[model samples]
Target: MGKSTGFMEYKRVDENSGAVKDRIKNFNEFHKHLNEDDRIKQAARCMDCGVPMCQAAIRLKGMVTGCPLHNLIPEWNDEIYQGHYEHALSRLLKTSNFPEFTGRVCPALCEKACICGTVEDAVTIHNNELFLIEKGFEEGYMKPRIPAIRSGKKVAVVGSGPSGLAVADQLNRRGHSVTVYERDDRIGGLLMYGIPNMKLQKEVIIRRQKLMEAEGVVFRTSVDVGVDIKAADLLKEYDAVVLSCGAKNPRPLAAADMKNTKGIYYAVDFLKSTTKAIIASGALLQDKVTLTNAKEGSYISAKDKNVVIVGGGDTGNDCVGTCIRHGASSVTQIEMMPCPPVERSASNPWPEWPKVLKTDYGQEEAIGVYGHDPRIYETTVKEVISKNGKILAVKTVKVKFDNGKLVEVPGTESTLKCDLLLIAAGFIGCQEYVAKDFGVALSKRNTVATSDPDVYTTGVKKVFTAGDMHRGQSLVVWAIAEGRACAKQVDEYLMGYSNM
Candidate 1:
């Protein structure tokens, strides 16, 4: 309530992104932050309602709503409205350890739950958050807040993704020594490989890691816990162990045809290779790099190739953008589910997250270059056709849901010429190696089994699990929440009290 009538006077204004033509040329962040006055104006849109739903992480129809970290959005929005940037930042960090990461990558559950969004556009909470943290960093107000005392306890965090980082940060701040182990060469597990640099700059993650280092969090890279080291070794050497290894075992399409194609690849491998090339040589667009160990001889250049991406989610859209930027002749994305309505339906009411047709960053970039939306609704690949062990085309068919199962609709069969086939289906759960090695019982779904909601312990003693390992694949905010909550459980197990 900075200006009594500020909400009435101001319209929601988000930060402007860089021009698509220039941005897609390189793998880098392009979302420009709003200036001081502009950001305050945007923040003024928050009414700071009496019953702020944005702070409540509720669920409706089995889907999550509001901030998963349970951030005090209205409180911080009011702070930003009054031009209290530092205060807003302080309030933000109370729950979220990495606002910068969430600010860039999160789909913003808080915005959907904003009271202002019931009937109108929501407050620009996400943009304002980005502005506040970026300003904090630029003004030299951001630094590592090292713990004042040591509890003489050591904690081992398996995985360096959002959840693992959040757990280590909180545990370290609670006067415990924390060490994070990552299987990747870089510290960021998924952020380094699963995500593209253009959306979330790898440098942003590295910068945060440096701050955590100064705060006395030790990071070990390229060393797997279950393989290189043993789970029993960790339990004996460390006081507590928290697992945040993400759900990344991809679900493969069941097909009996068995084209045995060479060009068919998992979406994760493509994204990982693309990011590696970009980081290794500062090459992102159209440039070809050959891996010595590439089983498929020579790289499948997206340049002048007809590419069909099977899946219409963020990962599929990422492939679309990357291929277009890589000089693909044409691109098409197909989703098995029917296309969503352009607007929220009658069943969906205010203060609930609206699921509607919205163009994401990658889709927008693809449309800018390719002249049309690349997605095809209600379609799935029937079979991949290859010649001489090389992918050439794919047969697709329109599908309809019948009793919750996909059934092919007759007379809709079609063949799409495709030189490359990328399957962006989805993940199953956490990798089985570590969980099996530790003898920790997993749920039928393969996620680390937790007997209680808040308690993170598994069947194995002194072993705890969090993030995707426990909760399955989810948003970044959920990962952070799991990490924070999991650390509290670990604290209770070690010191006989849970101050964290």
Candidate 2:
């Protein structure tokens, strides 16, 4: 601990963010870093307790708490408090492969499980982490670590998302030749498109990609394994293959005539198209400008239209932000479940992933522009009102749970003007084409199925899987953890021993 009594002396100080009104004008990161002095004070708040739950990845009451990567939170907090910037960064990188990515986007499970937060505000673990990694880059400490000798083994990573990137980074550093294949025109699979540019800038992903390339990881964009490149060909050429394809099979809406409606789109498609347009524009995105449409031959635009997004999770929140940035006249988000309590419920005690209501940046921006939170809790889409095959409005109904079944309440039906409807109801599983092509069996959850009692390996030899493809839809931090563990197993299979 930097100072034993520092937790008592200093209070938590979060990183400052730009006002929502000013931030919504452009699609860029708006959260500003804390000054060095204040960052130190925030880090000093870490008590370095003997039982530091911040880094303890534990499962309780069916919910995961703390950092899944099991990061050395106390060690790094002390390093930051003592002004040992490089040491702090080293300690951070020991567990996380992409602290920069997690820093910007992760929900910060570490803070939720923090012992300090049990009584008071938690230490600024997430902000301190962002500061350390960015400091590493600024001070030129983050450089390519090319392997000195070749291991004479080759590995193919069948995705460019977080998990695939982690596998490639780890395997390449271990002297194995690794090549990452992505179907999209650019790398950083979900990171590049699924997430909006306002939350995580495209340049950050590209910067890391360039560094990975410099370190001798080959990236093949627009190459879809099992389609553009045959799965059999990969197995014949490389010693091993790791499938990290994310779970992108979107859950369908049961709205009447939803399929034929011209203004309907998946939440991923909407968010992806907006990011692509923003990146292609080379500046802040403008209203009604079309880049590559999410669906072939169909353009998605929300400018001056009343948009209704289905789902109240992060993806829907992203859609809310994107449509607002596109100048949508009005926006509303619908959730099937009841709104969570403002604070943690008695059933959800400390260190069990606090189930509290959070006003995210998108909600804040929506409230600033529309003068109210756009979410309609305990409600769901009932139908898609359309005319001439175009969406004109959305019908919704309030719902309640009875006998563990969702039942729509009577006399609570309403309709809202909706020129655009985005389905953000979450993913069901991985797309079927790739899994079928690879001859991999699937579990009941529609995820890639491995041999009995053995994960990461398919029934077919020399084939492995990770990330959402293996574990179903999960957090990016979990994807990286899965990738690291899968890489270690793959290394052991190849060399009969491993140190990845």
Candidate 3:
């Protein structure tokens, strides 16, 4: 705890973002960091409750709260308040593999579960976290902590996303020789290509990857384990293999098939192409793609075109923001769920994550540029109207929950002119072919199944699972947790004990 009266004295201040009009010109990170003094003040606002819920990471009444990685929130907050930033970073790195990613992208369950938030605004834990990591970088205190000696045990990590990275980091620290293999050309998985650069700059990921490489973790890219290198090859060479490939199986806007529209594209496909183009150009992305780009709209820009994004999740909002930066004539996002109340409802008490309407950074940008919010709640895209090969417009209908099911309201159909459609619906599970090819068991949810009877093992001998590949699509924090825990299991399998 910093000061008993700190929460009362401080008023929450949001960090600054670039002017909407200016940011829309290109897909770049727009938020400016809070100054040191203000960051410390924000840290001081942590009430340090008797039982701090901020880092509890729980699902209460179907709502999650606090840091899912179970970060030592109050301790770090105290360190930050006392100007012990390096101490705070140490405590933060103890559990979370990447605070920078969470600080920028997470919904901040910790803030919602804040004790002070019962009556006042929650402390800016997320911003303070960003401050700590960036401070570590600037202060030159962030460096590789190589193990004193290698354990002579070899471990293989499949996937290179947050989970696999966390597992590799932990296992490497425990003195095990580790290699992380990624199917993509880059190492950061979703951080590398799935998300837009405007939200998470690629250099941020590269910084960490470089540090990890210096720490003795080998990274191999563009190597598909099931294809380029056989799974049996890893089994023969390594003591254990941990799978962290994220759930890439996108939940179809199965509705997307209804459109039969040629210009329609998946959100990930478009965003990946956009980021690839940006990475290649080293500045604002180009207006076109080379012949090899695999995504729709790789050949075109959203400029001067009306766009309708289906699915009001983060992906949808990202699409809206990207299209805006690309100079979309107008943008709208539709969701099946009804709008949530602004305040916590009675069913949601203190420490429970309030189900509320949150207009994220993207929506804010859209509003600033368009004069109104772009999201339409309680709505669903009904159909897509297209010319011979291009999207023409989108048809939508108002919907409501009736007896636990979505019911379309009568006579609520409406149409809007549209030239492009991006589906931002969430994913369902991991891809099946590779898992099936290895004869790995799958969960009822279609994720790689792990049973205690197998000691956290997959169907194939010496095979293990973690992250989205093991647990389905989830937050980065949870994926990190899974990877960390799974590495411990693998270490134990290899050496009969795990120091993790």
Candidate 4:
């Protein structure tokens, strides 16, 4: 918008990573930001297309085409290009409750729909967004915005994950007294632990938490609803209750029944333990040390162990990186699905989520360290080999689709030495106990079932569900969107109208 031919004049520039050798020594973030002028040039590349598909959240073949939040992309790009940094940040914050989180982790659905990418590289929208937000923070433009008035209504948000935080933030700003409950010792549910410090630093989540607290949102940690506090009690105290509890029920591994195995863990549990250890040790945070390392004896350390990850999605990739940082002897990731194409297929054209290969930071670091990619496609564990209740190895076999069913090949079984096995298979749905305790129904897929298809209300009165609890496992961006939408519904239900 700033320059008519800027797309042709400037090449797409992205953040560079610290060298693998230096970065793997610790779990700090490796990506470095571009300078201000370069980021402005990147923003200038926005074409200001008439349709602006980058902001259009169209669904094609069950895949999202653009940003689900419908971010004002071109508008903010113009603001950045015009040297209005605060204006750019304001436009960004209008649509996204947490640009810093989405900017770091989202797959950039907006960039894939950019008109410039039809032939050449798309504008560096994601990088530009990060630059704007981080610059806002550096310039002290981001501050606590305490509401001027109170509506005299209170809301209890269960879970301190992205969706719950979004709900609390929105409702607090709307003048409602909001309280967030988290089961973990820390506030951020998944962000604090599920994601490693390398991808999203723990301090970033804490910084936002402090800001939210200053703005009048109360945070309660180590308080598990239905256990530490009764679910019925929250309904009696608050005008409304919002369930942003994530999908915590992990899909069980086929070898889960091997109770005698010594070194098996779920991916989320493993990642959470590492963070808790890091926190307890005060290794990263500049605080007085408490425990030497993760709550003593709670963690299954990958140090000097041959680790095998059972899934090949993002969680599995995270395991690969974490094990590498732990100095694992060797690591391997297994995926049952065939490897995706290196480029988009004919049927999977532009605007649809690109079904192409993505070599994330973890995979890249694994290649740098191990001298080869660690992923094994079309393969799955056949049996967990153990001796004296200790894991020793794993037998795997190649699989293929036969009449819409996956069947293992007859003679492709093989074994890999596995000292530690981490199952990164994705979650199934929300934990049933929370929904059952609240007397809310669940859909056939096990996600929370709403009383009405058009609303977020659960079968239980005054109880609402959002985020992964309602939609199943999804991106942080979607969780934020769902939370905002659910908040509007709750506000309307309480006040008979909503201006959110």
Candidate 5:
């Protein structure tokens, strides 16, 4: 709990962001943090509500409404208010493994469920968190804490995403020998490549990876588990194996013949190419170096091209921003679902996840540069017009829901010039090859199946699964929570009981 009257006295102030005109020039973090005094004032906005729903992590109307990691928001806010930075960080780190990552990328579900937000703007929990973690690092309090004792248990974690990193961090902290495997050239799966650099700088991920390496965790990158190595070998080598490869199988457009089509790419692949190029060019380590100036032919360039993005989700939005940075001629986003209400409806009450329009940074940039919002709601791509195996344009049609079924309006069909088409339609589930190699049963949703939904153990003994690979595509906070839970299960299996 913070100062009892702080909520009434202090106003909410968020981190200042660079102007869209300037930020669009490079792929770097744009949000400028509030000074220490201002940040403390924001932390003081957390009221001493007897029941802090911000940390409740409850399910409402089929959607999770609060921090999935169950972060101790109130306690940390109070600590920050009291000027106890280290104490605040300790309490913060108790539940969350990577606050820095969540603080930047999380949609801040905790703020939506905040009791204070029911009447006014929510406390800057997300900003306060980022400040605390960054302060800890700046003040040299984020040093690695190598385990004092070893449990002699070995756990092999496949994947370096938040979930996999969480599992490795927890099990290693509990004195287990943990080795993380990643197929990519570097650590941090989604954080390293899937996400756009503007949202989260690659340096932040590299910093964390360095700290993790300083600890006992072993990371072996660029070694594909199912391909470069076999699951049976891991089973024989490690005491327990946890699959946290994540939901990476991109969903294809059901209506279009996208096969062998030029100028068409999956959103993640596009993002990865840009990230790889930036790293290779050393732009991340330099100041004032435009990220767009990365080595040519190393990445997909949206420069001077009319771009069409399918899907109105976060990935689609990211594509819009990346395209702008790439100096795209024009950009458009297509969403099959109808646009949400601008404000919360009566049915969508407080403490429940609000179903309202969210104009993210990418959309704002698109609007600023293009003079219009890039999203076209309730529309689907009807046909891919190609010439000589290359995409030329796309024919789209207006659609509406009838009896919960999508129906397209025949007369509303129209074609738009599209030199490059990016499919951000989201993922179906975890790629099946990894699950198949591990001999784990898959759920109907294509996630690794467990006898009990709450359990992490798979059909095969000594094999476990967590994160998107186990629960389907989800938030980073949820992935971290799942990883923590799975680590406990692995510990219990290795030892007679888990003290983790």
Candidate 6:
């Protein structure tokens, strides 16, 4: 509901990013926001399409193409265009608990499904969201809102990830006491460590954590529920229990020798180490942490090393960027799937998740530094050649999908010198330990089982599950949506009614 002809009159403008040559020298956020006036103009590009597909969250050909949280994109855009920022913030918060997180990290499904994109560029919905949330914080409207009354019912949330945090936030706002348990030393499970600092600054999470604490949510970090604390204790103490621990079980590389390789690491582990080292050294407060000035043994550094990354997803791109920032000598990414088309093909049309090549910031940095793209498609690691238990090189082979089955091509095997190998091949499912301890059944896909797909309650009494743990690995927006829905179910179970 922006201007009647706004979509036709205005063009989309995105936030500026730091130059690759300059930004690769440090571990810091690179994107700079547009000024208020320019941001408003961008919002004006939202068209009153009558049937706004941007927030539809529809599934077409097995791929979801809109905001999972179903954010009120058009309404907020109208408010932003009219400079009613407070109204925009209210509408935004009604659906999304953390615009700041999604705005920065989400792949922008809304933009992909935007009506404006059919004819021209899509509206800058993601940037506008970040602008709104940041403005709320800057103007002091994001202060803690203590509940007027307490329901006196306690809910124990395991995880403190986006899903867990959303569950805790919604339940706490409904006057129920919520305590989030995290296994790590800090809160914000994935946001804290799984992601690299440059993509999402840790201080942003810390700021939200502080505000949540002020709003009466209790957080206990470094407390692994299954091992450190028994499930029985939590069941007895809380009125309801919601498990939101994410699917962190990374898929292992097929290379047998990789198990004993010293220089091999999971993508998340590599990212976490770098983030921890950055925080430990207080690099964010001081100058940037570069290869030379970084503390020794603080992280798995890639400086002057030949790096090879497995997988071609977002996590793999992140590994590429991190390696570049670590001053890698050379970088290579091996992808099992064939390369996608540069532009949308006839078979894949608009309003479907575009199956096109996306060169993320990581690949961009790699190209700028290496003078060529690092991705090697239709290829996979055939063997890990190690020397004295340390990785030395990788033997790779080109592959093709024949009758929907992957088959390696003959005589295409090649060897490359590799010092460090990072696996970002995605996750198989949720880890089994927590589900086993809770006595909850798991689906065939390795997610928590319920009576129905939409249900969140587990077979165990007073217990429920949400997020990646319940639905397998998914986006942060989906996790937040699942958390909110699960919280409503918990509220109804506790009081026999829920208006959440």
Model 6: CA > 4 A from native: 287-294
lDDT of 3 at 157: 91
Preferred candidate (TM-score higher): 4 or 5: 5
Q: Is candidate 4 or candidate 6 better by TM-score?
A: 6
Once model 4 is optimally superposed onto the true structure by TM-score, how far is the C-alpha of residue 148 displaced, in angstroms?
0.8
lDDT per residue as tens, model 1, 92-155: 8898888988888888888888877775688887887787788789877798898889999999
Writing each residue's lDDT as its tens digit, candidate 4 over 78-127 gives: 99999999988999999899988988888898998998999789988888
- Superposed by TM-score, candidate 4 places the C-alpha of residue 491 at a distance from the truth, in angstroms, of 0.7
**Backbone clashes (count) for model 4:** 1
Ranking by TM-score: 5, 6, 4, 2, 1, 3
Candidate 4 to truth, TM = 0.97
Instruction: TM-score each candidate.
Output: 0.95, 0.96, 0.94, 0.97, 0.99, 0.98
List RMSD in Å for every model shown.
3.0, 2.6, 3.1, 1.9, 1.0, 1.1
lDDT tens string, model 3, 113-217? 888888888888888888888899999889889999888989999899998998899899999999999999999888788888878878789899999999999
User: What TM-score does candidate 1 reach?
Assistant: 0.95
- lDDT by residue for model 2 over 1-500, one digit each (tens)? 65688888988877667788777776778888888998898889898589989899899988889999999999999999999999999999999999989998899999999988988898889989999999999999898999999899999999999999999999999999999999999998788899888788877898899999999999999998888999999999999999999998989998846567788889899888777766656554444232333343333678899999988988899999888887899999999988899998889999899888988888888999999999999998888888899989888999999999999999999989999898999898898888898899998888999764237888888999999989888889999999998999899999999976
Better of 1 and 2 by lDDT: 2
CA lDDT of every candidate? 0.83, 0.88, 0.82, 0.88, 0.92, 0.91
Clashing pairs in 1: none
State the local distance difference test value for candidate 3.
Answer: 0.82
